[model samples]
Structure formats: C-alpha cells, structure tokens
Target: MKKIEYGMDFVARNLGIFKCPVCGRSFEKIVHKSVSCDQGHLFDFSKKGTLYFLKHGVKSDYNDETMWQARRNVLQAGLFQPIVDEISSFLSENRSLRIIDAGCGEGSTLKYFENKRESNKDIYVGFDISKRAINLATQGEGSAFFCIADLAQLPFAANSFDAIIDMFSPSAYGEFERILKKGGILFKVIPNENYLIELRHMLYEKNDNHYSYSNAEVLSLFKQHYPQARVKRINYEFTLKETSFEDLLYMTPLHWGAAETKIDDALATGLAKITVDVLLLMVEND
Candidate 1:
C-alpha cells in the first residue's frame, strides 16, 4: 500500500542510522522495503507505518491506550511547552542532528524538537516497548521515526546518534554509551520533589511518605555512569482546567498505586493549577 511504501522510503534513504536489534550489526542492504544485515537478519517496515526491530519480548507496562491518549491531550494543551522550549533551545545550534527519544510514549515530546526546526535537517527516532504507543506515534508526520523496541538493548549501531533524549523515562547508560559518538549528549528529564504536588497532596494525608522525592540516588547513578553529567531543574506551575482533571490523573504515574475511591475524590476536587517540577541531565558521552 502507499502507506507502507512511504515508511519503506524513509528507511531506504537513511539506512546508515539503523542496525539489527537482534545482532547489533549494520544492515548490509535495504531492498524491497526490507533491511538485511550481514548475518542474514532482515526486518521490514510495517504497513502500519512503523519499523520492526524488537527481537525479544515486546511488552510494556505503559501500553494503555487511555493513558497514552490522555498524555497526548495534556501535551497538546501546552502544559509542558516550557520544558520543550528548553530542550529545543539547548539543541538549536545543531542544524542537523541525529536524535532518539527513548521510551517515547505517543511521540509528542520528541516531535516538539522536529516542529521547532526551520528545516527538516534533524533526524528524530523515537521508540517504546509498547506496540500501542508506537502505533499512535507513527500516525503523525514529522522528522520522527517510531518503532516498538526495548531501551536496554538499542537497535542502532555504535556512535550513531548526536544525542539521546529520555524524558520521564528510564535510563540505559550502558546502551547509551555504546550508541553515542564522542561529545554526544544524553538529555534526560526526571521529576523534582514538587512535580505534581497537587495530586500527591490531594491523594495522601498531610506530609505523607509519598510526598517526599529525592534525586540523590538518581544523580548518584548518573554520575556513576558519566562523571561529567550536569543537572538543571526546570520548575514552574501550569494552570489546570477543570476539564483536564481526568486527563491529568491518567497522564501521570502518581495514580498507578492509588485506589479508585481516592482517584474519584481528586477528580471531584481537582486543583486549578499544578507544578511542573523536573530536573534535566546533560551528559556528554566523551
């Protein structure tokens, strides 16, 4: 079909950026919309408009349609535009950059960089272990390419990217070090203590244990991998609409352990605004 061909065309043109997720080897050829490696591992771009590179069990806890849809709606509402702007500004100097968004759910966060560019010089590849997430990600047109793949073992060749972005996602430092060229950056975002404070406060009693968040352990782990990594906190508040009450609850992990009763109460008594507190980590592979 035309859709499949369009997806194939992209792989054929930029074949240098991909590798076999199974063998971790560069492709030998890309013919008839299929990429074949030296060892004979071949993968084809799907008719569903995504590339298939996940060799192992492709399952994710974050693969819920309702949750991803709520996330998409919240992002579209400009609640996290400030963080997007910060990332875009950080990479503005690179006219042509090869970027990857690890654990990219629905792909809006990665698409922000592509849309901000004056030209389509940036190559943005975003992948999540969730098939449902990647399916929704590929539905849009942009500088981004989506796939259902694991982060622990990335499917790209060594030194293939200029930067890897992990927004509110898990970090794979070992895999990250392998794929990034020297001087490349790993742009990661983690929550600050006050992130979604309104929700936490409403869900728990005053000064509850869940209300406390410390980045000390996270920072220590980052330093253990990249000693030169720098951290910056982007903190602010976004006014919430009563209509976004449900979407906000679904978009965050804060409700993953909450009871239905608590969730309903928060929905009924929603905050007019919530804080967007996050820490951005910048680490050069070198």
Candidate 2:
C-alpha cells in the first residue's frame, strides 16, 4: 500500500461540525451534542464517519462506478497538471483550511492537492452527484467526505467552507454563496477556446467553430452574480504523449462525437502538443 500524506490525515482529524447542514457555517469545533443551527435543522453524523446534509432531490446517472474510474485514470496521468498547479498556487496562502470541491468527479484534483501540500491541518471534502465517485474517493489515502448530492442544492449550510473549487462543472451561485465562509475563496475553472483541439480536429475531420465563451463574458457573468469577487486567468500549453492524447479524447465531452476511424487515425498519428486555457476566478464570499 502507498503511504497516505499528511493532508489526508488532516481531513480525518476535523471530521465533525466543520460543516453545518442547514446554514453551511464552518465551525472550528463542535460545541453542541447534536449538530444544529439556530434555525433548528439537525444533521447526524453517519456510521461511516461522514455527514449527509442534503435533503432535497438529486440526480442518479452520475452514481455509476465505471465512469468515475475512467475519470480518475485520465486525471492521474498528469495530463491536466497545469490546472492542478494553478489551484494549488491560488490556495497557497491558506493553511489549515476547510476546502470543498464541488462536482469533484473522481477526486483526483482534491487528492493531488492533499498530496502536494505540507499541512495536515486542512480538511478536504469532495461532493458530487455520483455516489460511485465518492466511494472511490473514500477508498483512497486522502481523507475526503463524499456525498451524492445536487450541485444546485448542496447539502451543506451557508458560509461553511474556507474555499470551494468548481472545475469544469455546473455552478450554483446561491449555494456557493451560502456554503463559502466570509472572505472565502471560490476557484472556478473553465476551458479556453483551444482546449482539446486535437480531438476536435479528429472527430470532425476539420475544425468546426469551437464553442467558447470569452473571458469578458465570464467576467460579466461573475460580476453579475458575485460583484465583490476578484478573478484571475491562467493559460498555458502542454505536450501530450500517445497515452495522454488518448486519455484527453476519452475523458472530454467531445468523446461522444468521435468516430472509430478518427480515433484510430489519432492513435496512429502519435504525439501532439495542446494548449490549455483555464480561467481561475478567486471570488470572495460577500
């Protein structure tokens, strides 16, 4: 077995009361016998030593295990290391933090952070609509609480997390605002226009008009929703090995449209360099 890092140990130590189910207030300690808020909403800690605060309806298809395993493989290969590096740099100032990764697919990004950082004082929580993803994450060395919950309606209470990560996933502005602590940072990463161009080229046999919203458009959207937040953009390029190329195609949303012949052509063609444009928005919870 591989050794688990200190970050994993940190998450396990701060297990309870860090997140309030009703209001999303993150507490340094659990003072009460039962976890409750002033609103009288109570949540119980599970036998597995995790919490399930989400009570509303949730989606089901994401609970499949196979999809999560594939996602984990793609991420673990370091194909998307630039994005991970940016996430780490963004949170460097934060020590002993309570971090949550919303729509945390296979938990690779969260695990990467846990393994890279030195502190065992921070708690990392990964929540997704998929129970399979959560199960796989829990099995790993990193300490993360997984939940099958909706992004639009998070199970956590307001202002609970010191930081929240939204990477290539759906966003719930209200829920984000509710769960992030005051002055908390929310890092939202979206793909740039050139992301996965090789796969796009192969699938279409020609470049179709790639659909990408401008940075200005993203800025406008964030301004409208989170006026007080500060935002930053990080863009870079990475060389891809044959396996990385295949992983890129397989893991992206573009895989559905790729023809078998096109995939074969890409495999035969060998190595390629792809540009990665990611927008990292560091928003403050106002």
Candidate 3:
C-alpha cells in the first residue's frame, strides 16, 4: 500500500488515542483521507505516512534534512545503543504497550523498539516538530506511526500512552503527565559534562562558557518534579569511524550556531573518539 494509504489505516485503528488539537474532542476514523472530530478539526496524513498537528509551523535548527539524516546514521551506528537498551528493558515489563517518543527526530529510537517487538499488538508513535524528520521516519512504516506535533500541546488524549521517551528533548511535564497512563514510565535523558568534549574544545577554544558544560540546572528541575525519580549515569567513549565522525559533526547541536569556517577548523583538530556522557532519569506515575 502507498504510505499515505497505510498511514490512514493505521490512524483509523488507533483513532481513540487521538484528540482534536483545536477542540479537545476525540478523533474518529479516517474519512476522505483525513481524520476529523465532531467539531470539524480535520488533519490529513502526509504522503510520507505522517500527520502534522501544528496550527503554525515552528522553526528549529534540527529541521534540516541533512541534520536528521546525520542523526539517523549516527544512531544506527550503535553509539546510543546503551541508552536504548536501558529504556527497552523497562518496556519489556508489559506484554503489550503503547509508547510515544516525544520529540522523536527521524524516529531512529522508535525504529529500534519496533524491530524488537515480539507481536504486532505494540503501538509505537513518534512525534517531532520537524516535518522533514517525520517524513524521513516513514521510510518503511513497519509498526510505528509518525507525527509532527508540539510537545506542549500533544494531539494524543489523556492517559493514552504506556510510556513516554524524552531523549535530549525539551520536556513538557504537564502534557506528559496528561497523556501518560497511570503507572506509566517517563524516560528522560540529559547530557552530562564531557559529552562531546573534543568538539566543544575545538569549536570554542577561547570561550570558557562554551567549552564548559553542565547538567546541574536540568538535574535540579527534574528532581523538583519527581523527587523519587531513579537516575543513572551512562558515561562511555565511542570510537568513531571517519564517516561516523563526519555525521557526528552534522548531527550535534554543538555545531548549530558555529560558523562554517569554525566547523572546518574544528574538523582539522582530528578526533578519534567522542565522549557519550548522559544521565537517564526514570520516574513512574503513582
């Protein structure tokens, strides 16, 4: 089936989970290739098999196709497999699950879980604000659904998901709480100091602020929200292949604001390995 047709069918099967972005009413099955609520809020699935739930388009540095492709390649290289493994273990608790990857760029992480599914009953939904990222995520359309959605205003209904994964993305804790089911898990990943330290040093050699990184504020904020949250520090170094190193430079936000000349200069420094230091915060709804 065409991607658009497949997406419409998928959305039809999971229509109960969706709520209208405007009216807050539940969405019904696909009609005329679009899903609409009683109040007349209609959304069409894109040709690439994803839905856009934004009233106004949002601009982000991660919206570029090159950046998303780089991210997918780097992730598939197994650099972030440890983190994926950690989350996957928790997901195994339930025989059937409904998972939402909040801010899932290119859907690489969701694709990992989809591949590991033991049955077709598991529901994997990945949403990002980037259209290009969601477009790329629809390549195979095996068992995952992709959407362009806002974190603060999720299109899914209250208590819709079994787990929510927020990896290196901004957290809309209130929205997360609303959409996640009772006793659901929230896996939040934040970068720690020394995460890509080589690139930081090369890019901002003279600027002390840019060269130094910290997760103190993020940690404090998360603790405030979930005091009993379980935290794990994942620190390691990944030996980079030449191609992987190039993808790293393109994928990371560290190089987002850096000039092309500066990036070229950083590339000249020569990095064989990069630090993958991050904290995984796990909290369960009571």
Candidate 4:
C-alpha cells in the first residue's frame, strides 16, 4: 500500500460534467443536457457514472483474474521500475492532475505512481476492459478510481483528462484526443525489439520476433491527428529472479506458446537479466 493524496479529494469534489466527447469542449456542468456537440453528435452518461462516446467496440483477452494476479506479482517485484520511474518523472511537477491509465492492468503501475508521488495528490483513474482487474484495483487502499470500460469508446467526456497513459496496450487515438484537455499530454509506452529476450529464448528455444517501430513512424501517425507532439525514449535492463520466472511467463501475451513444462524448467534454471526498451511520447491535442 501507498499513502493516498489529499489533492485527489479536491478533484473528486469538484468533479462535474466534463469534456464534450464530440467537439472536445469543456463544460462546467452536465444535467438534463443531452450531451451534443456542434456537429449534432450526441452522447449520454450511464447510470453507473460513465459516459459512452465510442461508436464501435473493442475486445480484450486480459479478462482472467489469474493472469492479472501473476502480472501484478511480477510488476511489484521491481522488474519494471525503470518504466515506472519514467512515468513518475513526467508527472512529478503537476498538482491535482487528473490522470487516467487507459489500459491499466492489475493497477500496479497506477498504484506505483500514486505511492511514489503521494504529495502531488493527483486523481488517478484506472480503466480496463476486464472487470476482474478493476475489482482487484479498487480493493487496494489508494486514491485511484477504477472503471471497467473499453478504450475504443471511453466513458469520459472530451477534454476531461489532464493526462492519459496507454502502456503497451491498444490505443484509440481518436478517443485519446477526445478525452485529453487542451495542451494535456498523452503518454504511450510501446515495447522495443528486445523487451524480453531471456523469456522468449527459454520458452521458444529461439529468438522471438519483436514488434519493431521507428520513433518517426509513430510520430508521423500522431502528427497526422495532432501536429504538435514530442517523443521521448527510455531504455533499461532488469534482472529476473527464479521465483518470478513463472509469473513473467503467465503475465505476458507470450504465455499462449509457453508450455508448463518449459516454465518449470526455467524456474529451476535460476535468475536471468533482460532488457526493456520503451518509447514514451508526449502528444498535445491539436
């Protein structure tokens, strides 16, 4: 556990009808007002306190609690501290910022940021498609608000967030642009070529094909929608303990190809070090 910030209380208390999902306008209050934009596109808030603005739907495979628990254990072991530190550094100066982890898994990253910057008191919101993950996140004593929702169609009004994070998860650029406040930053983390070479080598007995993308390519894509954006890169290496071998396998999307027998063998083989390459981009909504 981490200490909850008092500034979170301020954001929660002043919470009202947020951004306009269609036009990206900020509204002071939302009431009998059927949320409509200048283009006549309309949205409605659900009774459960979430607004539905997405037209199409997206699905996810991380619906299992077992997988989330395994991922949490590995993350909590400090294997991904570098990435956490990078995220925290970007958020250190802000006070009472409205932050959302769009694809927050098991809430470890969100919790870590909240714990590290206890004085900032930012309102941390974690959203995932998996109900199990959100449920587990809420159980932890923190200032985080957990929601079960899809990123393709975010539940918040347009320009509602001060900052939004999408770490190694599917991102909806349109949805991100809609939710982020003007001049607000959206930080996205994507894995580099050698993110988990050790685990891939042990499980496949060969090199796993990594998803490679150039910073320019990603920047071009964001620039198409948002012309003013900057990209930052963070790279690090971490040593994995024997105890975390199984957890690492289970938590990764690579687990489908990993056999139980192979995992057990790796656990017995002892600790290994792996490199992590992450791309963090700060995109301003145009």
* The best candidate in terms of lDDT: 3
Displacement of the residue 269 alpha carbon in candidate 2, Å: 3.0
* Residue 202 shift from truth in candidate 1, angstroms: 1.6
Please give, for residues 52-170, the per-residue lDDT of candidate 2 as tens digits: 55666556666656556766776786766777787777674545788899988878888887887747457778877765676677666666665556677676655668889889887
Ranking by TM-score: 3, 1, 2, 4
Superior by TM-score: candidate 1 or candidate 2 = 1
What are the models' TM-scores? Answer: 0.93, 0.75, 0.95, 0.75
Which stretch of 10 consecutive residues in model 1 shows the poorest summed lDDT?
Answer: 1-10
Query: Which scores better on lDDT, 3 or 4?
Result: 3
Show where candidate 3 strays beyond 4 Å.
none
Query: Candidate 1's residue-wise lDDT over 104-156, tens digit each?
Result: 98988877777777484888888888888888887766757788777787888
Candidate 2 residue pairs that clash: 23-157, 23-158, 24-157, 24-158, 26-160, 158-178, 159-178
**For model 2, what is the error of residue 5's alpha carbon versus the real structure, in angstroms, after optimal superposition?**
19
What Cα-based lDDT does every candidate model obtain? 0.80, 0.66, 0.86, 0.67
Off by over 4 Å in 1: 92-94, 206-209
Tens-digit lDDT track of model 4 for 1-286: 1222232232235445244444555444333424444455555443333333444564557777778888888888887778778776766474778888988878888888888888888877787877667666655667676655666656577677888888887789988887788877888887665667666666665443422224456556766866666666677777776346667767887766567887678778845676777677677555
Clashing pairs in 1: none
| Residue 94 displacement (Å), model 2 | 6.5
If both were scored by TM-score, which would come out higher, candidate 1 or candidate 3? 3
Q: Candidate 1, TM-score vs. the true structure?
A: 0.93
